[model samples]
Target: MSEREDFVRRFGGVFEHSPWVAERAFDRAASVGLTAGNVHSALCNAFRAASPAERRAVLRAHPDLAGKLALAGKLTAASTVEQASAGLDRLSPEEHQRFTELNAAYMKKFGFPFIIAVKGLTKEDILAAFERRIDNSPEEEFETACAQVEQIARLRLRSMLPGEDNA
Candidate 1:
């Protein structure tokens, strides 16, 4: 089989179980020229061989909200924040005002959105992280951002490939 095919077969195992996610994964892989079966297999092998922490780190390295005009290299960062804040319309007016203020301050302080992977996290957990992280120094916040990016990427990978050895 070709490298891409192998990649699709192996790493794709995670995604294949979820066809919608698989399609998106395939599109992403293809965009990066892992379109060949063998190449894909190699990529999958590499991803699978990584330690769980390493995988998480890789995910975190991405810029949040990849394509957003405001985020620049921080697309994933923006998207994660947006996703986490999705239900904020349910908040009271005061709560909404506080969130907006917090978000603005976070951006002003960190030069990026406060980001955390929302998958598997409760809304309260997300809110807490946002509040707590705002107190971090720029250097500390940068590292925290990096960590969050990895977490988000790992979560995306896991969602894309469920049954595979995520480690």
Candidate 2:
């Protein structure tokens, strides 16, 4: 495979199950270039160019933090590690139940799973965010989820490609 193909395949999961983000970035990289410096921005642009439905699909690709999929070990490798970093994997039963309740309520209210960039956050921090965000209007929460997805993509890209900072 070509380097661009390799790049896309390797970085595809940076946006959960959405490989289109990587593919779109690679298409731009072909004309310009791919570097640790600019790859995240390219991907973000690709995400931005996506249609509303497509963007929603990308958001839907992400599993809820500490949701059933995480508990069942069904999340992608990147998601598993990200959630674990927030100590989600070691939740107390009561905390787990709380997360479960919150997850369901948030999804019911917003029509999508709640997302957070959990890498640097404590579980308490995540829970606090969840509580506060649940009160947001659906439109506000959707925008928040999109921004968090971008944050997650940047973090995942950094892990796969060294020397990257948020851009």
Candidate 3:
């Protein structure tokens, strides 16, 4: 089989589990004109090298909302904000209201909604991050966003290939 085909067959499992992740992987591959096989191979190899906690960490680095502020430009900020709010449903109503207030304040201060990869964090943890990061300067926060995006990509690659070495 061609390398591309090999990659697809080996990593197709990832797509089966998370279509959104698969789409992002495919989009990344397409951005570089990589054959499906090569993209699959890279993704599989990356996934294979990551530990479970590392994978969760990667997911946690993504912004809860997308769109105007998403590094990938695939999700809108409003949608991402809604998603974040929904994910916090475990919170008491009062806590939820507090989060909403904090989110608004974060947006006002930073000129962008607070972004966190919300794959694996509890509502409490997410809120903690908001509290901690709300004090960061714009430069610091921008750097954080960039770092989180990279982490998310790495995790996505690792999920696509669970046994391969990335390095």
Candidate 4:
């Protein structure tokens, strides 16, 4: 594959479904030769600099935690693994129902799914955060979602590149 294609193939899903973040970060990655930290910073800078609508698109691109996409086995590969890591994939019926309710409420209030980097968190932790964040103002929720997206991207890059201050 060509270098650009390779770059995108590797890092595109770092930002959920928003490959545009990878597309935008490519120039920087090329310039800096693809260290984990450089690639992570480039991708995050692109995400952070996006217009509100574009950033919201990134947020909207995320699958809801333990929601329909996951139920239907439709989450991206990275998402599947991450959710499993948090035990979200093993939620009981009651837990799933609670996630469903919180997801609906959160979406109704914020116009996007509740997003958190689930790498080192438990289902209870995620549930607690979901409940707590539902009370945030729209602006606060938007910023929080964006930051979570960045964290997710950072973790994804860390997995791919390893051994850098991608944190």
Give the TM-score ranking, best first. Answer: 4, 2, 1, 3
Best by TM-score: 4
Worst 10 residues of 3 by lDDT: 15-24
TM-score per candidate: 0.51, 0.93, 0.48, 0.95
lDDT of 4: 0.91
List the global CA lDDT of all models: 0.51, 0.85, 0.53, 0.91
lDDT pick, better of 2 and 3: 2
Output the lDDT of residue 162, model 3. Answer: 58
Which residue pairs does candidate 4 place in steric collision? none
lDDT of 1 by residue, 64-87 (tens): 321232233333343445454555
Candidate 2, residue 77: how far the Cα is off, in Å: 0.9
Report the C-alpha displacement of residue 127, candidate 2, in angstroms.
0.4
TM-score of 4: 0.95
Q: Between candidates 1 and 2, which one is better according to TM-score?
A: 2
How would you encode candidate 3's per-residue C-alpha lDDT over 1-167 as one tens digit per residue? 86445545544443223333343344455565444445654554454455645444444333433222333455433334434554653456677677768867877776655766565766677778889999999778865754554444444444544554351
Candidate 3 vs candidate 4, TM-score winner? 4
Q: Lowest-scoring 10 consecutive residues by lDDT in candidate 4?
A: 158-167
Query: Relative to the unseen true structure, what is the C-alpha lDDT of residue 66 in candidate 2, on a scale of 0 to 100?
Result: 90
